[model samples]
Each structure stands twice: as structure tokens, then as C-alpha cells.
Target: MSLSYVGTQLTIYVGSAILIAGVLGNGINIFIFSSVRTYRNTPSTFYFLVGSIHNLLYLAINLTFRIVSVGSGFDLTRTSLAWCRARSFFLSTISVISFTCSCLATIDQFLATSQSAHLRRYSKIELAYRIVLVTMVVWYLQGIPWILYQNISPISTTCVRTNAIYAIYVSVYLLLVLCVIPVVVMIGFGFLTYRNIRLTIALAELRADRQLAKMTLIQVVLVIISIIPYGINNAYGLITTGMTKDANRILIESFISTIVSLITYLYYMGSFYMFLISSSRFRHAYHTLCDNTTSNSSSLLCLVDDDYFCLCDINQIAQCFLYDKTLDQCKHCLAQGQCIKGDTDTPSDYVCRCPRCHFGSICQHNTKLFSFTMESLLSPDLLSSSFIKKSVSLSMYIIVPALLLIFGTISNIFSFVTFRRPKTRLNGAGHYFFTSTIFSQLSLFCLLSKIIHIIINLRGLFVQPMVNTILCKILSFLLSSSTRICYWLIVFVNIERLYVTIYPTKRWLKEPKTAKKIIIFVIMLTYGVHIHELIQYTIVPDPKYTVHGKWCVTQFSHSLQIYNQINTMIHYLSPCLVNLICTITLLIRPARIRANLDKKKSR
Candidate 1:
């Protein structure tokens, strides 16, 4: 086979493997959760079952589509429009629902476990019914755009515009529903979860197995990673689809879409492992299964003591950081022990001692009565940071910024209302600039903040093997670009004010309507300047967590670092520069003119 053919085969196999893994993994969870008669009746079971259902559907579609697309031999561009639209609509909907269901599972775990007595008694059947209703509403809600604008036929695998007007309508609707609404919901929930976690931690409430909340956080990250590639792909598609008939971009986007689909499954599959690591029950069960299946396995060499689980072969902890073989000492306490000791045991095999109050086993003490206290956990500093972090919690991220935008818009409305008032009809140029600033701030605020958090938060929740060097750079660029929009708007405000004062009779400054048009134009232009950032910062797996059995994103390139510096320069330094220059000009201009007039009068 040609290298191309081999690559294609590998892709298909990988996709299949991921799909099977997710289905079987989640299916086993379903069986285990269901077969236990006591477990089947619990309210939490409903969420777990529903989340599994969504995962199964998502995996099936993803696996089938990827395998078919790879082997089908037909130009993706030449596939039937119906096939394209239907596939697009269903897959997107399922993907969204999967993430949403997972999030709901987290929420359910919180409410169910936290409030055990009266609230715990809520019927599983009623919970299932409510989920069904929600599923129905969400399905129809997401399907509207598909029904209205989806054009699938065999000739070309692409979206068919009902017409330009309808296309715009569908785009607007889809943007609001898929992109905007979920982002808002995620941000809200993220904030709430952050607060709850902090409070739990602070109040000494977080036990060893607070897996649900962490699982929820991981789910959020999955959504972010899944959406980002798709979001960028779609956003780019929307911008360039009509302007350039480039096959490469389309193909590139399709590849990204496929990758994102696969990663979404990875997110679902990986969470079970996270649960296994964090939850004692899952960990115990998993280890029991592993031991039962492979009596003579290499893993059998591992030893578990009261303080630590050790991998004999590697001389390291089962899950945590590796021992520094070269140092042969506790790098964690390097200040005291810089050199390796003569002891045969590796540092990784050494049990991790608590920062304070070194006593018996660290894990055992956690469960001991009066060993921990809410007062100790909920320290003054911890509480303060919790308040701040919660105030800016990821869930409320969208609403807070959105509310700020609304307030800015309201400020404009006030200006307009004042202008229309009989008493204030003769409002001056300052009023016009103030009104203009309101609209500018509103537009930039809504677009930049919402889009940023939507993309950023989703990445945090979902992206696996988290370090995608390329993706990190792309994200950094997009962030820089988004922030630039705000800075540029501030510059415009200062410039407009200075212009009106310096040349009041200019036709541009005379009409408030003209100023509004300019503001809108600037807002639109902001996208053009930063579009390159999205392209430059492509998604790649994070490096730090990959080796240690954790996943996350981090920037790899200095290009993003440069861009960040530039953005900071513009956002902070430029605004300050503009303000400083304006302030000095306002102060000095009058004094200079008066001095000249006095000189003329004496002459």
C-alpha cells in the first residue's frame, strides 16, 4: 500500500478503536450500575445511564462516519448535500447533548450526595421523565436550523442555503443556540461548580472521593476542546466559504472536524479512568478486575503499603510523579536533601508526608474523626480567593461579561432617551461620543468576552492529552485578537472625542449617525485583524500532563508569547498612552493659546 493508503488505514483503525473503547467502557459501567439491584433504583443512576446513552450514540456515529469517510473513495466535497447536512446536524446535536448530559450528571451528583435525606428521596422515574423532556426540547431546538437550511445531496457534501436570507437566519439561529446558549450555560455552571468545590475544600468537606465535581470539570474541558476546533473550523468556513472556493481549507476543516469527533469520544472514555484513579470504589474494583484477569502479569510486582502504592519495576508511585533516578533523593524536599542518600529505596517509593502534622498514614488520617476541621480548611485567605474565583467562576463568566455589555447598551439607551427628551434635545458633541462609546463597548464586549470564554472554558473541560502545542498557540492568538478588539475600541473612543473637540465643524464629527456607522465598521474590522491568530495557533496536545496520566493545554510557541506581549502593549500601554496624551493635550493646549494671545495683546 502507498503511504497515503497506510495512513488512511491507520486513521480508520484508530477511530474504530476509540469508538469501541468508549462504548464498551461506558457499557460496562451501565451493566455494573444496573446489575446491582440497589444501584438500579438510585436517582444518580438516571444521569449515569443517560450520559452513557449519549456517549454510546456519539461514539457509534463518530466511528461509523470516520471509517466510511476514510474508505468511501468519493471526494468529500462531492458527497450528497443531504448526507452532509443530516450527518452534520445529528452529529452536532448528539455531541452537544453528550456534553450537556455529562454536566447534568455532575449537577445531580452534587445535589444528591450533598443533600442526602429529603432531597435524596426524589424518584428516579421522575428524574428520567424530566431528562426525557429536556432531551426532547433540546433535540427540536437544535434541529430547527437543520430543517430550515440543511441541503444534502450526492453531488457535493456541503450545506445548502435555502437562500442568502435564510442562510443568514440559520447561521444566526445556530450561532445563538449551539455556540451562544451552551457557552452561557457552561459558564454559569462552571462558576457554580468552582464555588461549590472551593467551599467544599474550605469547609473540610472534600473527601478523598469527590470524583463527581472533578469529573464535571473534566466534562467541561471536553466540551471546550471539542467545540474549539469545530468552532474555529466553522467560523473560518463561514468567513471563507463564499469568498474563496479553496478545496484545501475545506479538506483541512473536515480533518479538524474528524479529529474533534474522535477527541470527544476520548473525553468520555478517559473520564472513567479519572474516576478510577480518584474514587476508592472504582479504584478497588478496577484493581480487583486487573488482578483477577492476569495472575502472572508484570503489574503483579507492584506493592501497596499503608502509605503508598509502589510500582516495583519503576520504583515509583502507581499514579503520581516519577522518582528522580539521578538525584536519588526527595526532590520535593531538595532544600534539605540535595544529594542522593545511600538508601536502596527510590524517592518515588518513599511515602509522601503531609506538609504539616506528620503522623501515621496520610490517607487514613483523612477519615479519622476530628483529625480535620472545617476551620482549618476554610482559612481566611482560602475564603477570600474562593469568593473572588467564584465571583468570576467559569459558569457565570458569560453572564457577567454579558451583563456588562447590557449595561453599556443601557447607557446608550439612556443617552438616546436624554437626547430625545424635550429638555435635552440640544445635547452637545460629548453626548454623541458618549452614546457612540456605549454601542462600541457593547458590541466589542459581547463578541470578545462570550466567544473567548466559550472557546477557552470548553477547551479546559474536554481536550484530552491536554497539551496540543499547535492548538495552544492558536488559542493564544485568538485570545490576543479578542482582547485587541477591546483595546482598539478604547482608542477609537479617545480619538473620536479629540476629533470632535479639535475640528467640530467637520462633516464626520457633525452627524451622530455617521459616528454610529464608524463604530459598527470598527467592530466588524476587529475580526479581520485577528483572524490570522486563529490560524496560527492550531490545537495540539499539551505536554505536561501526557507523561503523568493527566491531560491539559499549554502554549508551545514563542509566537503566541510575542503576540501576548503585543496585546498587553496595546490593551494596557496603548490605552494609558491615549489617555495620557489626551490629558496632557487638554491641559497644555489652553495654557499655550492664552500665552500666545497675551503676547499678541502686548505687541
Candidate 2:
């Protein structure tokens, strides 16, 4: 299997494991730290409490999407426009908050361990509360740029940054704020806290304070280990973005990126486990709490002896899964889906991990990206390999193309001839009409070539490989550019008429000189924008993913797709919209003058 696919399968389980473990661990941490009166008001513990909540939020929202995205191979952010803008905003805001809380907990521990009374006083619960509140507000405000910049990219059909300047700022922010600052602050304070306890173990460090210090300090080390690799990966990505690589190298890089991204979640999930390892008092608390639980009777507690291995077997794990059949966990499931019980002990803890199309937690959405192509739309049940032969009778395909070519040629020639007269060329309107007629002829000829190319390939006809390649590039390039040229020429025609409508007395408005310049500019601009077709377009033989016999195809890069689609829209819509507005305004505010007539009365 390719590493990307393998990595995707791994993430399906890994993300689930993290979600379950994180929720349970952080859940217990929150309960023990809050419910136990001895630890309730301590500033370090307060930060721990808040950090646990942030970790839960991170796992629930971010890691859940990460798992669904991998399992289905479709990102929700890309498909849903609101989510495209909101996911980045929330993830950034919440992650920075979680990282900030970790730092605060470490720094608070340092102060709690310090010999100085002044620095120690700074570790107050009231100040901790205010700091977290202010941090939330600041980071929420900081994430506003993401709301403004994140968008569903048209080319790649994925969510990505839309603004160049904002994208650069995001890269810098990812490197420094999310990756660097928290690690630095925690490590620095973590060591200081450790040194204070080591130097003055007998002087004044209480047992609880020492345990909390050890927990936070050990957690800091884990943070550095988990987070620094993530930072380095981000830097490597930035450095190598423009470098070209073979397909295998691209897959390898993608595999590594996926692996590193999963590892980054470890920092958020490992804290409670870190506490369990570093604090004996914390472990004692866990046992004491678990032994006392009466809510769910089905439990398994495994204890391994130093002298021998012991296995604890408990029946009735699914007892809680069926605790509430009326809960309707399978409401979002597709056909033949099975729900798996999770979330430790809750009755509402079922996630629908289906055998097919595991799209969401409950399998609610479609598993694949949906799109339409000409062959598919025309004959949904027919074989795509021999498209034209299978979809069309021999006579029908021949007759349609013949009719189109004859009528199109005649109409364009007639329009060209009509606009060629000197009397008709007295104004810019005639020039625009003549240019459009020429473009229309160009479009018709390209269309005929495209039809011939498709028919030859699909009907099992042979052409030389190099000839096919050249035809593929030339035909697609000429067709797209010529069609867009026509659209833009119409746009300019509307604009010129609108100008004449507004300024009837301006003699320059009636000249054909500016019209000629604009037509040339439109043709050049359209050709320039579509020049990528010459390089990006190519013939693919017997490909299942795209349409046509020559099979002209190129996958859109994320930013390029969004940009190209928007540009096409502007070219297509600008003229139609300009025409509507101009015609309506011409109707609304009739001009005072007319060409070659008396200056009209003021409306």
C-alpha cells in the first residue's frame, strides 16, 4: 500500500484512540482537581483545570474532524463554506489558548516553588482567572484574520488561505506563536521550578507543591518533545514549498506530513498521562476515585504483579452501549452501518464507524466528492472508454456536427460582412461587432476541432502519439482562449455603448480607434491568462478520472483553482452585469444628446 493510504488508515485508529484517551484522561483530571477540596484553589491546579478543558475541546473539535477527514478522504471545511471560514478561526484560537495555559501552569509552579514571597504571590487563583479570560479574548481577536482569509479553493476543491499577505502572517504565526513561544516559556520555567525544589527540598517546599511541580515540569519536557518536531516540520514545509519533486517523493512527503500532524496531537492528549507518571499523589487519587465509582457497574481493573503477569477479564463491556437504545445513535448511519461504543461510561457515547462511507461520527454525510462531466451526464449507464460510439448513433453524431459547422460559419461570415462597410464603421459599435464576429468564427472552428479529436479517440481511431499531444494542447488552448475572448469582447462592447450613452457629446466616444485597441488587448489578455493550457494540458490514455479521448486534464493547485475560477467569473459576468446596469440606467436616465442628431433636451 502507498504510505499515504497506510497513514490514512493509521490516523483512523490513532485519532479515535487520542479522542477516547484524551477525553477520559482529561475528564478524570478535571474531576479530581476540582472535586478534591485540597487542590481546588491552588493557582497551578487552576491552570491545569483550564488546560484540561482546552485539551478536551481540541480533541473533540479538531481531532474529530481530522479522523473523519482521513477516514472519508473528504474535508468538511472544503465542502461547507461556513466551516471553511470558521474551522481555522476556532482551531487557532483554541490551540493558542491551550498552549498558553500550559505555559501558565509551568510558570505558576515556578512561582509556587520560589523562595521569594513577591514572585510567589503572583501565583494567585484570582490572577490565573483573569489571565485566562484575557488570553481567550486576545486570541479570539487574533484569529479574526482567519475568518476573513480562509476560503474553499475552487481549483483544488479544498479549504485554504485566500490572501497572500494573510498567508505569510499565518506561516510566521504557526512557527513562532503556536510552536516556539510556549515551548520556550514552559522549558524555562520548568527548569527553574525543578532547581528551586532541588536546592530547597527541606526548606519550605510542601509535599503537594512538590508533586504539582514535578507533574508540570515533566509535562513541560513532553511538550518540548512533541511540539518541537511539529515546528520543524512546518519550517521544512515552508522552505521546500517551491521545490519540484518526483511523484514518489511527493507521496513520501505527504506521508511524513500526515504522520507529523498526528504526532502534534500527542502534546494535547499526553498531559493527564504525564501527571499519572510524575505524581504518586495523583496516581493514589485516581485509584481512590475509580474504586469509589457506582454509576457504571461494568468495570475492569488490571493490576500487574512485580513477580508475575495478571490478566483481568471483564464481561459486559457493551452493557453500557445498549444502556439506551432509545438514544438513536444510528440516526446518521448509512446502510449496513454499525455503531461502536466509546467515551468511557456515558450512555450517549456511540460513534457510527460504518463498514462503508465512514464520513462523520454518525456516518451522516456523503463519503466522496461529487462532480459531473459531459460523458457521465449524457449517458450515466454507458461505458466511458468508447464514449461517442456508445452514446451516439453513427448518423446522429455526424449530422449534428455538420449542421453546427455550416450554420455557425454562415452566421459569423454574414455578421462580419455586414460590419465591414465604411458607413457602418463610423462608430466603435461597428468595430466591436466586427471583432466579435471574427472571435465567434474562431470559437466555432475550435469547437469543430475539439469534437473531431474526441470522436477519433473514443471510436478507437489511431493518431501518432506526438501528434495527439500537440493537438491536445493546441485545440484546448485555442478553444478556451477564443471562447473567453468572445465573452470579454462582448463585455467591452457593453462598456463602450454605456460610455456613449453617458457622454453622447464626447466625440472620442464614437471613434473606432479605442475599440480596436480594446479588442486587441482583450485577445492578448485572454490568451495570456490561458497560456497555462499549453503547458498544463495533455493527453491521458484510458484514464477513469477525467473525460474526453485526448483526455485533456490538469489538477488545479489550491490557490490557482480559486484564482482561475474567479477570473473566469469576472470575465463572464462583468459584461452581462455591465450590460444590464447600462441598459437599465439608459432607460432610467435618458441622455441629453444623440450622435449625428440635435443635442437632446436635458432629461
Candidate 3:
């Protein structure tokens, strides 16, 4: 594979891993810090809590966008000016806030561990909270200039600093403020923390109290190790910006930078693991929490989110055993959302907290209202890819769609042949019917493609990014456009039939040439109406997969969703109304004609 392709795949696989690990680690840290009474009382753990919160924010907002943009080539910042400004603003603000918290935590660890009573007094939870608030406000204020000055440049078409001076200021800010200053603070405090540990441990009275302190010291070491390389990478980039480099050298530098960028994410994803690794008490506490033992700690109420709180028995993290019984049970939410970690109070110890538009007890229901994908309908019942493929019974999704394709292929071919005859080309309906059959057949194949797509991803098979993107966009467009156009074509047919009935005496030869042009017009109009299906759909990584794979997903903005609803009403509902009116008119018009003929005969 080419370097670009290799780089893209690396981002997809590696970036996905980082996103998952980072979110889980940071979230677990928050849960542990907030739940444990001993932890909640400490100023250093308070800063760690704040840092973890920002780490979650940073990973959710920035790393997600990076994977989507670089791995899948759907960069939202390029298209939306609002996203361009907001993304950089949050990214910078959160990075700084998290780093600041890290620095504060390191300093607090030193203060809390020291023998001096006055220094220990400085490590109050209240003071830590105030410091975090002030740091957030300061960093957020610093980031306002980014929102105002960030723009999608005409040349690069990437988010750029429109002001040269501010761009330089940002680079300097990243280098000195986030990188150099935090590293210095962490290293300095870390040294003092070690010295305090030696002095305090000699007294032999403060061992339990020093467990968190030791965890913080190790965290400080991680902070320095992760931050120093990032700082060096930035310094190198800045130093070499004006220098002309050959293609090979530039490519090598780009690869190195990518690796360094991944390393920088380690600080955010590493804290929980760092604690587990360094401190035996912390590890024991984690184990105790997982085992749900009430021996050491009482059941404490923990805030799960703003809306809900859970009583923690202190054992499993949120939804640890989403696979309580088997691998299938583990992926019971179909791997779409978090499981609320639970105890034996209920039938299951985990409740699925689904992503947006998904629901049901185990998150089995997807609110893809009016979506026609067969795979969606069968998602709740889907088994492991291996089990489904190896079992004798075909899935409902496969069986029903498979049968429909078989009959659909046969029927459309027969219709196409019937419409092909010169005698059938008497009016517009014949032409419309002919084209409808073509899209009908196309739609069936698209259905077949969808089934294959689901199965391939079900088995966790990787497709190249560019090819996958194209398939995702094209398959969705064809299926949606064909569905819409088929409905409208039926409406058009009824309208044509009504026209012929009303003015049958005015005999003008309806040539196929005119019919052909009209068909082209209708086709163009149909595609134009549903064009957003192509623009809005994209391939995103599927966490359900054991190996690297993607799911073809569509997301519409609020305005677009509104437009789509209106659009669906127009394409889907309008045809039914038009056809209903046409059918009624054709029936009534013939009876009225018969009545007039009877009156003439009596005369």
C-alpha cells in the first residue's frame, strides 16, 4: 500500500482504539473519583477529576473529528464555518484546561504529602475547585479570539487563522503555555512529591493517606513523558516551517508527526491505567469496586449523568459486562451505546445507555423512522456474524430481501420486455413505466448490495477507505432516489392516463421522442429532489465489529432534518394524494360521458 493509504488505515484503526480507550479510561476515573469517599475528600483527586472531565471532552470533540476527517475524508470544518470556529475553540480550550488541571494536581500532590502543616493546608478541595474554575474561565476567554479569527481559508480550504498575528500567538501559546509550562510544573512537583513520600513514609503513620499521593506522583511522571515529546514535535515543526524540504524528507516528517500526535493523546487516556499500575491500594480499591463488595466501603450514590444517578455497590464500571453471559450478550446494545453498570437487584446487572435515536431495554430499538434498510429492521435480533453465517437458518433480513430480489428481478425484466415493444408506446404512461422498471431493478440490486454490505461488516471485513466512501454514498443515493422516483412515476402514470381519457378524440400521435425527453426531465428532477442523500451520508467506524470495518451512516443537521421531513412528505405523500384524485376523476368522468350519450340517444 502507498504511504497515504497506510497512514489513513493507521488513523482509522489506531484512532478508533485511542478514542475508545480514552473515553473509557477518563470516564472510569471520573466515576471512581466521584464515588469513593476517601477520593472525594482530597484536593489532588479533585484536580484529577477536573482533568478527566476535560480529557473526555477533548477526546469526544477533537479525536472523533480527526478520525472522521483524516480516515474517512468527511471534514466538517471545511464545509461549515460555525464548526470550523467551534471545533478549534473547544479543542484549544479543553486541552489547556486539562493541562492546567494536570499541573495543579501535580502541585497539590506535593503540598498534601509534605510534612509542613501550612503546606498541607493549601491542599483544600475548595481551593482546588476555585483554581479549576479560574483556569477554565481564563482558557475559555483566551479561546474567544480563535472563534472570532478562525476561518475556512479560500486557498487551503482548511480552518486557518485569518489573522497572521493571532496565528503566531496561538503557536506560541501551545508551545510555551500548554507544553513547556505544564511539563516544567509536573516535573518540578513530581520531584518534590517523591521527596515528601520518603520523609513521610519514615514516620510510618500516614501510609493509607499516601496511596492517592503516590498515584498522583506517577500521573505526574506520565504527564511529563507524554507532554515533552509533543512540545519537542511542535518546536521542530516551528523551526522547520521556513525551510524548503524535498518530497521524501517531507513524507518522513509527516509520518513522524502523526506518531507524535498519537503519543500526545496518551496523557488523556493514561490516568486510570497509571493509577492501576503504580499504586497497590488504588488497584485493590478498583478490584473491590468491581467485586461489588460492601465489606470495605458503603454503597454510595453516584451521579451517572445530569438526568440520573446510580447507587454504586462499587464493583463494575459502567456497563462492564454488557456481555454478561456470552459474546452476544456482551454486545447486546448491538454495541451502539454504554451499559449502565448494575448489581443483582435486577435481572441484568447492566442497562444500555443508547446513543441518540436508539432505544429499548437493551437498546434494541433504533428510531430510524421511515428508513427502509432491511438490516435496521433486523438489528435487534442479529447474532454474531459467525453464528449467523454458519447456522442453517438464514436471518429474516437476508431471507426476505433475498426472495424479494429474486422475484423483483424476474418481474422487472418481464415489464421491461413488455414496455420495449413499439405497440406499448401509445402514451406517457408506457414511457414512465419503462423507466420505472429500470429503477425498480436498480433498487433491487441496491437492496442486494445493502444486504452484502451488512454481512461484510458483520464479519468485520475491511474495505479501502475511498472505495468504502464511494459505496456508502452511492448505495444510499440509489436506494433513496429510486424509492422516491418510483412513487412519483406511478403518480405521473395516473396523471397521463387521466389526460388521455379526457381528450381521446383529439388524436395526436404520442411519439416516443417526446416521451424520452419527459423521462429524462423527471429523472433529473427526482435526483435533484433527493440529492442530499449523497451529500449527507458517510462511512463511520463500526464499534460492533471485532476487526476494522465501517458502517454507512447518514446524519442530517436540524435544518436538513426538517427539510428531509418536508421532502419525504412531498415525495412520499404527494404521490398518494395525486393518484387518489386521478383515480376518482377517471371513474367519474366515464359515467358522466355515458349519461350525456344516453340524453343524446333519447333526443
Candidate 4:
């Protein structure tokens, strides 16, 4: 196989950029959070730091593959099945570790911030170890997909080998374990935290109130934001079924899918930012470190081979950032008074170049620089060419969504019916809310799966405004409505929890009739919002026009796109804001109440 110079160069450039960025960003994070003695060891930070490490590892694996594939055209059979299995296993484990760590962090915050002593006791090291061990088990168990699917097909040009049946089973497993479990857990934990927060506020427990509330908001938002893109992407992969031998189509789809997969990294990256935003201690420490650039503090610098640079105090960090750059002090800078006393020639520090800077360096005079835009990132020609090469079928499309809808319906119904009985009713509103969440999850999963199925199935069909007229509309509507339904269900549960906690004596909550009504109303209202999707997903096919083929499960009309973006903002972004606002309000109310009590006692 021969590689185009441009393709090889681009691969190297992108791979290098990703590796460098991941190393620095995750390195600084681990150092600041782990080594700093002042950080007051919290379970939240521990989980977060570990998660960052996992993210860096994930980046390393991805970068390694990108570089190797570009250089050698990525031959799987030549590399042996062992190499494939190893790569798959490493990738899978790191990915799991990243999300699992985030989950643990959320769980930690929820427990730590909760008002109940029983819940608060969950902040033990033993529990953390147990969680970590269990997560590892989950990772290995999930590796069944890789073990089952690992093979070398004669026609496959790429290194990775995947089959339709293997993909479907893995997709089903991933959807259930990773995507659905986290969604349900986030909603459940968020509600539990909200409830405990309200109780704390009523009792004037300000510290716990603020901490728990902020952490809850951060965890919920970060998890949701990061998971959705990758989740949807995987859902598409699962529904679209089959392993094509087409090198061109596979490469193009894989490249685009790689960008989508970055959503997982975004989730990991956002945690540091969330901590910066929501926790004052983190913010103060970060700001203080940034502002004091002149300070020769050990915290900021490490001597490496007689040159100064940053070092982190972790196994992962040290492994990632140990630089071997030769010592070359900035002679020009020293002569120009840019260097301080005793500063001979030192190696140029790795600095971030501005996107708008002309040169990839810190310019003395700022000049405009060109960077890759979204248009360049996703070229129209590339998309069209990729679409042209796609060998897709109607059955692939139909069966995938049908499978998802069926699976979702069955899972959600089981969750609801099993917990609906009088026997499990005493399990509390947490269990009931869990059931409701499963319904929303199924709704979202089915809608996405169904739509992708339609678009792919209809690609080569000559039916114009005939076969797909009604189907498109219903598919589109159901997808949108189900997603909305699921999003709002979570918020409803959170708000209900707040109500129950603050007003525990309310007889309405105790009444089975009232609870049932609330559940029905929430479910009905959620599905009602999805009605629009039912109306709009359908499109009139043109006899002369071939549908643009791709693996993503989304409607691309401007109006629909705008609506979905808004949906993302409302269901995805806005709830985060609500979580933050509610948490702050809950915390502040108690602080003010406590101050008044203190004043009274002093008087």
C-alpha cells in the first residue's frame, strides 16, 4: 500500500497535536490535584485525577494508531491478531476507566454533600477501592466484544476488524452498560443529591449543601455532555451494521467517527474546568499559580537535565511528560532582557501558539494566523466522496433501529413493571424515578436508532416521495420527541426530589395516588414533546436524487438541525444551569439562616 504525502503529513500533524495537547493538559491537572498537599484529599479529586490519567492514556493509544496507520496503511493481518487484541483491549480499558472514574467522582460528591449520615459514610477509602475494582471487572467483561470480534478478513485493508453480529451485540451491550446505566445513575444520583441538599438547607447545613449541590451539577452536566455524542455515534454504528471491505468508505467514516469519538475526551477534559468553575478552592489555587509566573516555586518548576520545566508527581504524569530536549538557553531573550539573572541558555519552553498567530510561536509582534475551520475539518467534497462509496442496504437500516426500539422497550418495560408492583413500591421514589428514567432512555435510544435506519435504508432506493413519505416523518418525530421526553424526565425527577426533601411532612408524597399521577403526567408530557419529531423526520424522496449516505443517525435539514441544537441546549446544556442554580439557592438559603441564628445566640 502506498500513502499520499499529504495524507501522511496530515496524519502526523493531527496525531502529534492530539498527543501533545493531551499530555500537557492532563499532566498539569494530575500535578496540581495530586501533588499539592494543600488540596485536602477529597474522594472527588481522587476520582477526577485518576480519570484524567485514563484520558491521557486514551489519547496515547489513539495517537499511536493514527501515526502507525498513516505510515503503513494499517495492515491488520500482517500485525498479527495478538497486536489487534492488545490494541483493542487497551483502548477499551482506558475508555471504560475514563467514564468509570467520572461516575465515581459524581457518586463521591453525592454522598459527601448529602445531609444523611448514612450516605455521608460512603466517603470511605474502602468503598473507593471496591468501586475501582468493580469498574476494572466491568472493563474486562466488556472486552468480550473485542475477543469475539477480533479477526483478519482477506478484504479488510484497515487494522481493525469488526463484524455485523459482533457490532450489534457490542452495541447492545455498550448501550445498556455504559450509556443507559450512566444516564439512569446520573438522574437518580442527581435527585438524591437534590433531596439531601434541600434537607441540609432546611437544617442550615451550609457547607455540605454547597459542596454537594455544585458537585452534583458538575457531574450531571459533564456526564451528559460527553456521553451523548459518542453514544449517538455508537448507536449509529450498531444500527448501520456490516463490515465493508471498501478502504475508501471505511477510512472516511472512521475519520469522521474519530471526531465524534472526541466527545468522550471532552467529557474527561471538562471535569478540570468544572472543578475550576464550581469549586472556589480549585479556582483560587489555579488562579494564584497562573498569576504568579515570576515565582520560582518548586510547585511550578522542575529541573530536568539542567534545564527548567514542569513535572508532575504521579506515575502516569512522569511517564507522559519526561522531556529529553537538549539544554539551549535563550541567548537572544537573555540579551534582550527577557531572561532573569543566572539564566544562561535554557531550552525553549513548550508554549501554546495562538490560533490567530501567523507563526507557530510566541511572536514579538502579533500577526494573524490561519487555523483549521469546521469547513476544512469536514470538507464537502470529502463528505460527497465518502457518501458515494458507501455500500449500504435497507435491511441494515431497518433491523438496527428495530433492534434498538425493541431492546429499549423491553428494558424500560421491565424496569417499570418489575418496580411497579406493591412489593417494590416501598423501595422509595429513587427506584420509581429509576424506572421513569429507563423509559426516557428507551425513548431516546429508539428514536436515534430508527432514524439512522431509515436514512441508510433509503440511500439507493428510487422511490420518490412514495415509500419514505410517511416513514421519514414518523421516524424524525419519534426521535426528537423521545429525546425531549427523556431530558425533561430527569429535571422533573430532580425538582420532585427537592420538593419531597424540603417538605417531608407533605401527605401528598405519601399517597400512592399522588405518586402515580405524578409519574403518569411526567411520562405523558415527555412523549407529548416528541410528537413534533413524529411529524418532521419523514422526507419526500426524489426519484432522480440519491440520499446522502453516512453512518450518523441524525436529521440534517436546517430547521431540524436548529431544533435539535436547541434541544441539546435545553435538554443537555440548560439542565446543567438549572442544577447549578438550584444547588446555589439551596446552599445560600441555609448560610443566611445560620448567620441569623449565630447573631441571635451572640446577643
Best-performing candidate as measured by lDDT: 3
TM-score for candidate 2, residues paired by index: 0.47
TM-score per prediction, in order, is 0.39, 0.47, 0.48, 0.41
List the candidate 1 regions with Cα displacement exceeding 4 Å: 1-10, 37-45, 74-89, 109-125, 137-151, 154-184, 201-209, 245-257, 282-603
User: How much is the lDDT of residue 14 in candidate 1?
Assistant: 69
Which ten residues in a row are the worst by lDDT in model 1?
361-370
| Alpha-carbon deviation at 49 in model 2, angstroms | 1.1
Model 3, 283-364: lDDT tens per residue?
A: 2122223334455465552323322223344443322111233322334453256655555455345667776555445443
- Candidate 1, residue 243: the lDDT equals 81
* Model 2 regions lying over 4 Å from their true place: 204-208, 282-603
Candidate maximizing TM-score? 3
Please give the ranking of all candidate structures by lDDT, highest first, separated by commas. Answer: 3, 2, 4, 1
Error of 4 at 28 (Å): 2.3
Candidate 4 weakest lDDT stretch, 10 residues: 363-372
- Kindly list the per-residue Cα lDDT of model 2 for residues 417-496, writing each as its tens digit: 89998888888878888888887888778777766666676544655878887887888788777877887777667767
